[model samples]
Target: MLKLGVLASGRGSNLQSIIDAVEAGELSVEIEVVISDNEDAQALERAAKHQIEAQYVGPEDYNNNQDFEQAIIDDLERNDVELVILAGFMKLMSPYFIEHYQGRIMNIHPSLLPAFKGLHAQQQALDYGVKVSGCTVHFVDQGMDTGPIILQAAVPVKEDDTEESLANRILEEEHRIYPAAIKLYAEGKLEIEDGRVRIAK
Candidate 1:
């Protein structure tokens, strides 16, 4: 089974999805640890409920981004994590950290990537008047949300949709596809080539 380290900074809805999949025996992976920069993050509580190792690594304690990332790396290595999942980690990873895990880290973004690459992605889609909006699971690279796409699920943008409404719809798809992407990685069915992801048979 693949061993996973998860990073999150919020309510952990996506993290809950992964835990649900594992508990239901739908995913073949082990959550070695769940680390959060925010001490108050609900992700930590979720992990604790599942009896998984949950830790708080405050970025404030470190002098710089590199030191913060190094602390995270040390925690991950100590747990023997094979893959890193960024469920909703608010910070952008430094190149130093990205290189250390390269192609071994995954993140779920709220918009069909290559579009709305950063925060408030649902608002971006609504502002652009897109007929369709969705979520993406992709590899984590040096650039913000510019990594190779692994999987995506599209949700129709309703004409009267508010940012919150559209975001909630997209979030459902996020909860679905993120774990599916992790499953593919766990099964050795994902390959990266020339900045794209290929799913194996």
Candidate 2:
């Protein structure tokens, strides 16, 4: 079974979805541990509820971003995690971390990706006047949301939608697709070539 290590910095609804999927036997992976930059992150609470190890390693603890990422590497190594998932970790990981994990790191973004990456994706879509918005689960790289996408789910951007409302819609799709993407990765069905992801035939 694949061992999953999660990095999150906030509410961790997406993390919860992964945990639920694993517990329900939908995902053939075990959540080894959860690490958060925010000491008060609810992701810790979720991990505690599931009896999984939860760690809080704030920026102050590290001398630099590289050190911070090294700490994560150490933690993942200790847990023997085969895959690292970034659910909502706000901090940009060091390029070294991306290099170390390579294809093992994955993340979910609230946009089509190669689109409104970095942040405020819903607002960006609204401002850009796009009628359709969505969420993407992609491999993590040094560039923000620029890695090969594993899966995506489209959501309609309504005319009267506020950022919060639009985010809510995208989040629902995120919960569905993120787990599906991870499952694909676990099943060895994802193929990346020329920056595009193809399901193995």
Candidate 3:
């Protein structure tokens, strides 16, 4: 079984989805640990429910970004984590961390990616007046949301759509596609080829 580690902030709704997938045998993987930057993050509660180890490495305690990411790398090594999944980790990783983990790290972004790369993707979509917005799961690279895409689920941007409504819809897709990507990775069905993800039969 693949040993998976999750890094998240806030309420970890996507973290809960991974836990649920593992519990239901939908994903053939073991959750080694869950780490959060926020000490009071509700993701810790979700980890507790699964009886997995949860850690909070606060920003105040770290002298630099490297120090913070090194703590995460150390935790992954200790737990023998083969894959590091970023459910909602908001921190921008440095080149050191990116090079160390390379393709080992994965992240789920709120927008179609290669489009609105950063925060408040829903707002970006609304402001741009796009007819469609989506979510993407991809490897974490040096640039912000510039990694090769592994999975995407599109949601229509309705004429009456507000940021909140659009986000809710995208979130629903997030809950679906992220777990599916995890399942594919666990089964070794995802192969990075020519800068694109090829799903095997």
Candidate 4:
């Protein structure tokens, strides 16, 4: 089974989905640890509920960003994590960290990607008056949300949709596709060719 180390900064709804999938026997993976930059992140609480090892690695405890990232890396390595999942981790990873886990990290973003690449993606889509909006699961590269796409699910933009409404719908798709993407990785059914992801038979 694939061993995952998850990093999150907030409510951890996505983490909950993964836990649910694992407990339901729908995903063949082990959440080895949950680490959060925020001390009060509800993700830790969720991890505790599931009896998974959870830790808080605040950046303030380190002298520099590199050191902070190294602390995270040490924790991940200690747990023998094969894959790292960013479940709404608010900070942008430094190149030092990205290089260490190249092609071994995954993140879910709320947008079609290559469209609204950075934060508040739902608001960006609504502000642009797009007819369609969705979420993307992708490999985590050095650039912000510029990684090769693994999976995406589209949601039609309703005429009266607010940012919150659109985000809620997009999050549903996020919960669905993120785990599916992880499953693909776990099954060795994902391949990267050129600059894109190619699913295997």
Candidate 5:
């Protein structure tokens, strides 16, 4: 089975979705551990509920960004983690971490991506007055959310939609596609080529 290490900083709803998929036999992988930077993050609770190993690696414990990421990297290595999924990890990864993992890390963004690339993406879509917004699953790279897309699911914006409402809708899609993207990786179907992702048939 593919071994995964998940990083999150919030409620971990998406992490729950991934756990649900594994239990349902939809994804053939194991979540070796869930690591969070925030000690009080509900993601830790979610991991406990699943009986998965959960860790809190606070930035305060480390001297710098590299050391902080190194702490996480060490934990992941100890767990034999094969894939790193960023469910809601708010901290930006250091270049050292990115280079070490390279294409092994993935993230799900709450925008179509290449569109609202950074934080508050749903609000960006709403502020731009767009009719459609969506979620994107992609490999994690050095840039903000500029990674090559793996899958996208769009949600139409309503006239009365608020950021919370739109984000709720996009989150549903995030739960769906993130597991599917990880399934693809576990099946050895994803290939990176020239800043893009190719799914082998």
Candidate 6:
């Protein structure tokens, strides 16, 4: 089974979805541990509720971004994590850490990525008057949400849609496709080529 280390910063609704999928036997993977930069992150609580190892490594404890990432890397290595999933981790990973994990790290972004590639992506879509918005699961690289795309699920943006409403809709798709993307990776069905991901049959 694939061993996973999840990084998150906030409510971790996506983490919950992954846990539910695992418990339901919908995916063949082990959530080895969850590490958060926020000590009070609900993601840690969710992990504790599931009896998975939960850790809090705040950046304040470290001297710099690289040090903070190194702490996380140590924890992940200790747990023998094969894959790293960023549900909502607010930190930008350092190039050193990205090189350490390389293609093993994945993140779910709330926009049809290569568009609205940074924070508040839902609001960006709303502000841009886009008719369609969605979520993307992609490999994590040095750039902000500019990694190779794995899977994306689109939702129509209503004329009356607020950022919150649009985000809520996109989050539903995030919960669905993030796990499906992990399953695809675990089954060795993903191949990265020419700045994109190719799903193998």
Each candidate: how many clashes? 0, 0, 0, 0, 0, 0
Candidate 1 lDDT by residue in tens digits, 115-180: 998999999999999999899999999999999999999999999999999999999999999999
Question: Worst ten-residue run, lDDT, model 4?
Answer: 187-196
TM-score for candidate 5, residues paired by index: 0.99
The TM-score values for the models, in the order shown, are: 0.99, 0.98, 0.97, 0.99, 0.99, 0.99
lDDT tens readout by residue for model 6, 69-103: 99999999999999999989998888999999999
| Residue range 1-201, candidate 5, lDDT tens digits | 999999999999999999999999999999999999999999999999999999999999989888899999999999999999999999989789989999999999999989998899999999999999999999989999988889999999999999999999999999999999999999999999999999998
Off by over 4 Å in 3: none
* Model 2 misplacement above 4 A: none
- Taking all chains together, the TM-score of candidate 3 against the true structure is 0.97
Q: Between candidates 2 and 5, name the one with more favorable lDDT.
A: 5
What digit string (tens of lDDT, one per residue) describes model 3 on residues 96-193? 98898888888999899889989998899999999999999998888999988999999999999999999999999999999899888888888887
Tens digit per residue, CA lDDT, model 2, 1-201: 989999999999999999989889899999999999999999999999999999998889878888888988999999999999999999988789999999899999999987898789999999999999999999987887899988889999998999999999999999999999999999999888987889985
Residue 62 in candidate 6, Cα distance off native in Å: 1.4
Q: What's the residue-level lDDT of 131 in candidate 2?
A: 95
Q: What are the root-mean-square deviations of the candidates from the true structure over C-alphas?
A: 0.6, 0.8, 1.0, 0.5, 0.6, 0.7
Q: Candidate 4: RMSD over Cα atoms? A: 0.5
lDDT string, candidate 4, 1-201, tens digits? 899999999999999999999999999999999999999999999999999999999999999999999999999999999999999999999999999999999999999988999989999999999999999999999999999999999999999999999999999999999999999999999988997999998
Output the lDDT of residue 27, model 4. Answer: 99
Clashes of 3: 0
